[model samples]
Target: MIILCEGKHDYEFIKELISKINVKCDVKDQGPRDKDFIIGHVVDGKRLSYVPIIIEGGKDRLDGNVRLLISKLRSVHGSSTWVLILRDSDSNDADSAFDKLRRDIVSLINNPSKFLLYKPSMDCGQGIRVGSFVYYDCDLKYMDGVVHFRFIFVVPSLEVFLRNYEYVNDDSRLHYAIDKALSDPGIVMQ
Candidate 1:
């Protein structure tokens, strides 16, 4: 399955998680702020890279390539591939970010003849509110050959996931942030 990532740490973490599930995933190095890197990778069968930068006058980290990628993926894959947008959490504007993303998703949904989005969410990486929580109790669904959830916050650092993981499942690396999301306790933005 192809995963469009926005950060290197995200690449590593997702690589590890998918490996445990015995899924072979290609991870392109999408730097901390690099947003256009995934556009080419989605349409091409090759390893790619990009420099991290923010879009001009926009909260999104792209230079209009994100829409292009989405359009191309829909045209080429045609509802048989998964385009997962792996992004960072904007704490100050988390709600707004989600709202805008949802709106964009609606536009994609109208074009059912093309590929449709399965799960699209901006994870609040590294900056999850201290008392925030999220929960979903299911085997999680898969699209094409990938299984994706709309969104889930995580600590980017392996050290951080390891450090706080024991507070949940002490033995499994993938269980920390995942378990936290499944049994989120405390005040949340919802």
Candidate 2:
């Protein structure tokens, strides 16, 4: 599983969450502002860090980064990899951000190979939305299963993932945020 984050801070936040959950996975630092960071990112036998250094862009480039990364991953890993994109909504409300992201994903996968199918939906009850892009092929040699492409929006910013604790300060050390979030009793409830 590959988790792509918008910036260094976002990557740090997800890395902290993964540690809290005791999961082993690569959460990539796609730079401070989303850009073409992972363009030549090699994923098979090489290390994840083999990706080229991309030029960081403005705050509005997250969508473009997501699009490019998804396309690159599809071309390289085919249907065997699952990509989870975590992006901050920034100024947009949760609903609006989700809608725009879903649209962008749909547009990117528009008229995909005849063997692939996709669905876009939101579960209002859980405040989660999903876009499933599935590729089906029986004879492929390298990658031949279903690949799930997910876009998860953190409303306002990644800080929302943490609960307010006496020790938690957004501007302080990142460890404090991680510790406070991990220590929160409600962390596992989600």
Clash counts per candidate, in order, are: 3, 0
**lDDT by residue (tens digit), candidate 1, 36-117:** 4444444354434322222223236431344444444432332233344444444544444445555564465455554445
Q: How far is candidate 1 from the true structure (C-alpha RMSD, Å)?
A: 10.5
Q: What is the lDDT of residue 185 in candidate 1?
A: 46
Tell me the deviation in Å of residue 190 in model 1.
Answer: 20
> Which prediction has the highest lDDT against the true structure?
2
How many Å off is the CA of 89 in candidate 2? 2.1
Residue 94 displacement in candidate 1 (angstroms): 5.1
The candidate 1 region of ten consecutive residues with least summed lDDT is: 133-142
Q: Ten consecutive residues with minimal summed lDDT in candidate 2?
A: 131-140
User: Per-residue error at 162 for model 2, in Å?
Assistant: 4.3
TM-score of candidate 2 versus the correct structure, residues matched by position:
0.60
Score candidate 1 by TM-score against the native.
Answer: 0.42
Which residue pairs collide, candidate 2?
A: none
